[model samples]
Each structure stands twice: as structure tokens, then as C-alpha cells.
Target: MRATIIHGAGDVRIETVPDPVILEPTDAIVRIVRACICGSDLHPFHNKPAGSDPRAIGHEFIGVVEDTGSAVRTVSRGDFVIAPFVWSDGTCEFCREGLFTSCLHGGDWGDENVGGGQGEATRVPQADGTLIPVPGITEDSELLPSLLTLSDVYGTGYHAAITAGVRPGETVVVIGDGAVGLLAVLSAKQLGAEKIILMGRHEARTNLGREFGATDVVSARGEEGIAQVRELSGGHGAHRVLEAVGFLPAYEQALGVVRPGGAISRVGVPQYVEAPAGRVLFRPNVTLTGGVAPVRKYIDTLLPLVLDGTVNPGRVFDMTVSIEDVPSGYVAMDERRALKVLVKP
Candidate 1:
């Protein structure tokens, strides 16, 4: 089998690797039908120190179950499924509470022993808990792209909106226009936010944001952007700010545009450590929420919508690449030439 490996920053390659097998009774082997590059994958692509050992990469995918371990009864071989970025046991306390990302026995893909999603196949741990079997939909359905988003981006955007407590008629300011950010705009719309302000510089992507429900697009940064959002929201700032770019500047913008009692939900996979937590959050009584989305928890809730055509979050994928060209996929996204890259193995 061939898989993607990250040797270092700006370095990704496809090479022949050993095929994965079911190691645990709860595991399943999924043959990749659709996979894609995630914005979070860029964190290591940009900052990973040189001279580090190479490792398998990629985490978002929808595939067909090729095999399963003895304990896997929820799904059988040949079942179409969506694998969340992380695998967790459904029996854990955290999983029962809808936080599968923190399950006691959960783990991520693309590790030394685990196969990456951008490959011919992958070994999925805790199959019953991590893989969401798609019913009434074939692998060749037109909804594959939309179903694929349930793996990470869509569920993640939904997480930010839910965590921020977006309500009907409330105003929302979404920072960043990446796939996650654009989908955050979609999430806000689905939650009934009357006003949606999307902050991004790219006109093409921001245009899609408009189609997703953004009533306004602020391309400015720093103070200018803050002022634009404030003016748009009638001077009190937005009721909710969703920060989808995992950078200091985006977070600062979130802090600047949120109303005094509003919330800032960050789901961009924070790239900074020490953030302004004193005067900004103290006197304002702003609530800071959002983290790695427990996508598994939201898949069931979002799948029906995708199937019913109420949303089209897959619009975020603007480019497609073969497994051998995944390196270029990374470059396209890193240089902002593509919003997201869909991989076909």
C-alpha cells in the first residue's frame, strides 16, 4: 500500500508502506474511497522542526469497510463509513457525555503504528465508536463530498457554533475564511443567526461565505476589521465570534469583535499559548469556548441534513488531487490557492 508521510516542514511524500490489519478486536480496516487535506495538517507542515523522523499523516476520510475484527458488530465488511479524525471507545464516560474526542481509550490516526487517511487503507481503532456507517447512501453517491465533511470540518464548525451558544436573531462574526471558517458561517446560519459577518481577505472564498449565509464580509485586519464588525453589529460588536484560523491575529480579532457578554468559540486548533485573558475577558464577561470538535458526537445530527440537502458544506473543497499528488495539495492550501483539497486514492 502507498501512504502519505511528512518528513519535515514543506515536505510531504507518497511511498509504499505495509498494509494495516485489525490489531484489536474493536478495530476495522477501511479502504480509502475519499480523503482530504485538513488546515490543521498545515501546522506541522509549516512549523515541524527539521531533522525529525518522518511519520504518516492525514485524518479526514470516508471509506468502505474492507474488514473488521471479531468484536466489531455495528458494521460489517463492505459497509460505507465515515471515520472521525480520532477513534474512541463508545463505552467511555466522556463519550457517553458527547465528548468522544476525550474518550479514555481514544487515539488519532497517522501515528507510527497507525495508517494515515490519505492512503489505500487504514486501521481504525474502536470501529463501533469511531466509524459512522452511512445508510441508504452508496460510495458513489453525489453526496460523498458532503458526507466527507462530516469527518472534521462540518462537525467542527457546528461545534464552534453550538459552544458559542448561537441563537435565533443573534449576530455572529466568523474570523478566517478557510473551509472551517466558511463552514462556521454555515453553522451559524443553520442555528438561525440573523446576521453573519465573515472576516477574510480572499474574495473568491468570502464570496462562498456569502452563499453560506454571511451577510457581510470584512477583509480588513486589526483595528479596521474590528471597527467594521462593530459598525455592522450596531456598535456593540457581534453576539458571537467564531475564530477558525489557528493564529494569534485571528484570536485577537475574535477578542476585539465580541460583545461585552458574548462568546468567542475557537476551533482552529490554537497555535498560540499565552493569549490576552485579563482586561479583555475580565471586564467584558465574555465566555471563551471551543476546542477540537468531537466530530463523532455531531455526525449523527449533521448527517441527516447533508442527506436532505439542507446544507452543502462540501463546497469548501475547491481542488482535487490523486494520492501521488498530495504534496501539491498541501502547497495549494498553504499558498491559499485552494480552500481545501479533496484526495482520491
Candidate 2:
């Protein structure tokens, strides 16, 4: 089987690797049909040590079930499914509370010795709990992108809006124009937000953001960006602000653009950074929350929206490539030539 592996910083290759097999009664083996390069993958690509082992990379994927273990009942062989980026035991306390990402038994696919998304096939633990079956669209070609989004980006975007409590006629500001950020704009609109403000400089993405439902686009960067958001909201700031880029600046921007009593939903995969506790805890009644998206929880809710054509998350894919060309895919995204890269195995 062929998979994408990173041998070191800036080194990405497609090579043959051992196929995965079911390892637990709740596990399922999937033959990946499509996958995408996530922004998080770029962190290790640029910062990993020079001598790190060539490891599989990728976390978002949609595929067909090749095999399932005895405990798997929600999915079966030949069923098309989407694997949430985070794997969880559905019976865990956190999972029961709909916090699958924080499930006591939750685990990431490609971390340390675990294999990742850049693969021909992979084993998914807790299959019944993590894989969301795509009903009645077993042969739909366009379903791939929608299915793949369930793994991360779209789910995270939905998480951002929901966590912030976006409501009809309320104003929402999305910081960042990355795939997840753009999807956050979409999520806000779908949830009935009357005004969606997107802060970004890229014309391609900001344009897509408008098509998705951004009522306004602020191309300014830095403090100028924050000012533009405030101006749009008549100095009150937005009722809900989504921080989709996981960094200090973006986080700060989200905090700066929300109303005194509004909420900031951060779905960005945080790196080594800290937020000012004094500012967040004392300034206004701001509610700060968000983490890795509970993708499994949103999968069922989003699937129907995709199937009905009410939402088209696939628009986020600005470039498409074969899995063998994943290195270039990474380059395209990192260089800002692509919004999101879709890779087919």
C-alpha cells in the first residue's frame, strides 16, 4: 500500500507501507478513497527535527469499509463512511456527554507511532463510535468532499458557531480565511446569523467567503483588521466571534472583536501560545471556549445538510491532486496558492 510520509522537515514522499488490519473488536479497516491536507500538518513539516522517522501524515479522510470487527454495528463492509479526525469510544463518559474529542478513550490516528491519514488504508478503532455512515449515497462522486469535511474542517467550523451560540439576526465575525474559517462563515449563515464578517486578505478565499455567506469582508491585517470589525458592528463588536486560526494573534483578534457579553468560539488547533487570563476573565462578560472539534458529534447533523444540498462544504477545496502528489499539495497550501488541497488515493 502507498502512503504519504514525511522523513524530515520539508521532506514529503509517497511510498509503500504495510496495510492496516483490524486490531480491536470495535475496530474497522477502511480503504481510503479521498483525503485532504490539513493546515496542522504544516507545523511538523516545517518544525520537525532533521532526523525524525518517515511518518504517515493526514487526518481527514472519507472511505469505504473494507472490514469491521464483531463490535462494529453502525458500519459494515461496503458502507461508505467518514472517519472523524479524533477517534473515541462511544461508551465513554465524555462521549456520552457529546464531547467525543475529549472522550476518555479518544485517540488521534497519526501521533507518534500511530499511522496517519496519508495512507492507502488504515485501521480505525471504535468504528461504531467514530465512523459516520453516508446513507443512500454509496456511489455519489460529489459526496467525497462532503464526507471528507466531516473528518475535521467543516465539523470544526460548525463547532465554532455552535459554541458561540450564534443566533438569528445576530452578527458573527470569523477571524481567518483558512478552510475552517471560511466554513465557520458558512456555519454562521446557516445557523441564521444575519451578518457574517470575515477578516482576511486573500481575494480568492474572501471571495469564496462572500459566496458562502460573508456579509462583509475585511481585508485589513493586524490592528487595522480589528478596527474594521468594530466599525462593521457599530462599535459594539459582533455578538459571536470565531477564532479559526490557532495562534496568538488570531486568538487576540477574536477576543477583541466580540461584544462585551458576547462569546468567542475558538476552533483553531492551538500551538504553543497563551491567552491573557486577566483580559479574558475580567473584561466584559466574554465566554472563551473551543478545542479540537467534536467531529463525531456534528457528523450526523451535517451529513443531512450536505445530502440535501443546503450546504456545500466542498467549495473549500481550491486545489485537487493525486495522493502521490501530496508534497506539492502541501507546498501549494503553505505558499497560499491554494485554500485547501484535496487528495485522492
Candidate 3:
């Protein structure tokens, strides 16, 4: 079997690895049909420690079940499925509350012995609890990109908007215009936000944001960007702010644009520690919240929309490549030449 391995920073390679097998009663072996590079994958791609072992890379995929453990009754052989980035058993207290990301027995794709999403096939523990079956489509369909996003991206963007409490007729500002950010703009509008100001400079991508429901695009940065949003919002700033970029500057910009009593929902895979508590926090009364999206919780709620064509978040994928060309897929995204890359295995 062939899959991706990260040898060190900037060193991603396709290599032959042993095929995975069911190791637990709750496990299943899924054959990859499609997978893709995520922005979060870039962090370790650029910052992985030197001399580190070649570890599996990628955490978003949609695949077919080749085999299932005896305990796995939720899905059977040959069922198409989407696995959230984090794997969990459905029986935990947190899972019961739809917080599967924090399930007592849950873990992520890259942690320790677990394999990741970018490969020919991988072992999925807690199959009954972790995999979401796609009914009516047993094989790849035209809805592939949209279904693929249920693994991480679209669900994440939806999380940011829901956490921020976007309201009908509210003016919202979304920081960043990457795939997730653009989808965040889409999410805001779907939630009934009347005016969406998307902050990004890339003409091509921001133009796509307009198609996604961004009423305004602010190309400015720093205080200039803040002022533009304020001007659009009549000097009080936006009623809600969605921080789709996880860096310090983007985080601060989200802070600067949100109105008093408004909230900031961030889901861009944080790169900084200790969100800077700024001086304006007290005077304007801004609330901050968001964490690893409970994508499993959102999968069912958003799947019907994707199937019915009410929303097609798959447009975020601007580049598509063969699975063997995965490294170039990463390069295209890292260089900003592609908004997102879709890989067919």
C-alpha cells in the first residue's frame, strides 16, 4: 500500500507502507477513495522537529469500508463513509453530549500509533462510533467534494459560525479567505446574516467569497481593515466576527472588528499560545470562544443540505490531483497557488 509520510519539515514523500488491519473489535479498515491536504497539515510540514521519524501525514478523507470488526454493526462491508478528523467511541459522556472531539476514549489520526487519512487504506478504531455512513451513494458520486468536507473543513467552518452565534440580519465580519474562511462566509449567510464582510486580499479567492455570500470584501489589513469594517457597520464594528485565521494578527483583527457584546468564533487551527488579552476587551465587552469542531456532531445536520444541493461547500477545492501527486498538492496550497487541494487515491 502507498501513503504519505512526513520525514521532516518540508519533506513529504509517497512511500510503500504495510496495509492496516482491524486491531480492535470496534475497528474497521477503510480503503481510501479520496483525501486532501489541510492547512493545519502545513504547521508540522514547516515546523516538524529535525531527525523525526517519517510519520503519517493528513487527516481528512472519505472512503469505503473494506472490512469491519465483529462489533461494528453501524456499518458493514462496502459502505461509503466519512471519518471525522478525530476518532472516538460513541459511548462516552462527551460523545453523548456531541463533543466527540473530547471523548474519554477518543484520539486523533496522528497521535502515536494511530495512522492518518492520506493513504491507500487505514485502520479506523471504534468504527461504529467514529464512521458516518453515506446512504444512497454507495460509491463515489458527484457530491464527492462536499461529502469529503464533512471529514473536517466544512464542519469546521460551520462550527466557527455557530459558536459565534451569528444572528439573522446581523452584520458579520469574517477574517481570512482560505477554504475554511470562505466557507465561514457561506455559513454566516446560511444562518441569515444580512451583511458579510470578508477580509482578504486575493482577488480570485475573495471573488469566490462574493459568490459564497460575502456582501463586502475588505482588502485592507491591521487598523485600516478595522476601520473599513467599522465604516460599513456604522462605527460600532460588526455584530459578530468569525476568525478563520488562527495567527496573532488575524486573531487581533477579529478582536478589533467585533462590536461590544459580540462574539468571535475561531476554528482555523490555532498557531499561537495565550490569545492576547487586548486593552479593548474590557471597554467593548467582546466574548471569545471556539475549539476543535465537534465535526461528528455537525455531520448529520449538514449532510442533508449537501445532498439536497441547498449548499455546495465543495467549491473550496480549487485544485485536484492524483493521490500519487499528493506532495505537489501540498505545494500548491502552501504557495497560495491553490485555495484547497483534492486528492483522488
- In terms of lDDT, which candidate is strongest? 1
**18-122: candidate 3 lDDT, tens digit per residue:** 888888888999998888899888888889887987798888999999999888899998899998998999999999999999999989885666677888888
lDDT of 2 by residue, 194-310 (tens): 999999999989999999999999988678888888999989799999998888888878877889989988888777465676767466988888778898888778988888888
**TM-score: the better of candidates 1 and 2:** 1
The C-alpha stretches of model 1 lying farther than 4 A from their native spots are none
lDDT of 3: 0.89
Best by TM-score: 1
Show the lowest summed lDDT stretch of 10 residues, model 1. 105-114
**What TM-score would every model get versus the actual structure?**
0.99, 0.96, 0.98
Model 3 worst lDDT run, 10 consecutive residues: 275-284
139 in model 1: Cα distance from truth in Å?
A: 2.5
**Residue-level error in angstroms, candidate 1, position 314:** 0.8
Whole-model alpha-carbon lDDT for candidate 1: 0.93
Q: In candidate 1, how many Å is residue 234 off?
A: 0.7
Give lDDT per model, in order. 0.93, 0.87, 0.89
List the lowest-lDDT window of 10 residues for candidate 2: 272-281
TM-score of 3: 0.98
